[model samples]
Target: MASVLDAGPFFHGTVAALQAGDLLTAGYRSNYRPDIVMNHIYFTALVDGAGLAAELAAELVKGVAEPHVYEVEPTGPFENDPNVTDKKFPGNPTRSYRSVAPLRVVREIADWTRLTPEALQMWRERLSALSANPDARIIN
Candidate 1:
């Protein structure tokens, strides 16, 4: 069984959708499809923790202080196993987005594990360095 901590935080909204589409098509270099739902995005950065995840989500959508967050659990071996080869899509290229398992919302985000002030600051610095749009705000 996968623990709650194993799952990474995610954001579901218009901003996420756009970012997800960009990640799938541009980042992953996958073929675009009309059926793709471009309305939500998810991040699997366990190192950053939930607080950073929420902040990143909020940055995408202007005026939204706290976006709805969820935890995604891996259901099967294929999804649970780490990407050792660094392949964008494991089994089927067409089903790249299908790797994710079911998602459960975190009603009390404060109760869940969060990043410390120092950790958040470090992550912000690292993210800023890695971000393409340096001018864009990462945290709300």
Candidate 2:
């Protein structure tokens, strides 16, 4: 069976917030929409070492899986403005796509490599084939 991963409730919260009049900007104080909510979902899955982004992409293409989602709100004071909030912003002032690629690789490799001998062998062959294709974009 194809594995399924859900991005969890945070994404739902973000969607609800958007529907409820809260703006969903890519970063703070900036208006940017995302290409897909699944990007964030795949990111979390990779971070938690659940699955590869490619697997997520495949599942997405197959229309048989749901990816993780997250809700982001103003977590800190306005940039360069001291009178913005009662407390200082504890983290980065601007939002960004956190570490995603490395974690995804970890999960994909782990999921396929750490297993029964049969799966390992299969993965080994796949890896060999992949290695032979030097033109393959490792990052993609």
Give the lowest summed-lDDT range of ten residues in model 2: 99-108
User: How do the residues 1-140 of candidate 2 rate in per-residue lDDT, one tens digit apiece?
Assistant: 53322332111111111223333332211101112232221122122222222233323234554333333223222121121122234432312222211121111122221235575457456655655675532221
Which candidate wins on lDDT? 1
Record all residue pairs in model 2 with backbone atoms less than 3 Å apart, i.e. clashing.
7-67, 7-68, 11-69
Residue 51 displacement (Å), model 2:
7.1
For candidate 1, give the lDDT.
0.35
lDDT of 1 by residue, 1-140 (tens): 65443333432221132221222211221111212232322334342333455555454444755543333333432232222113434543222122433333333333444556687578566655645454532110
TM-scores, in order shown? 0.36, 0.25
TM-score of 2: 0.25
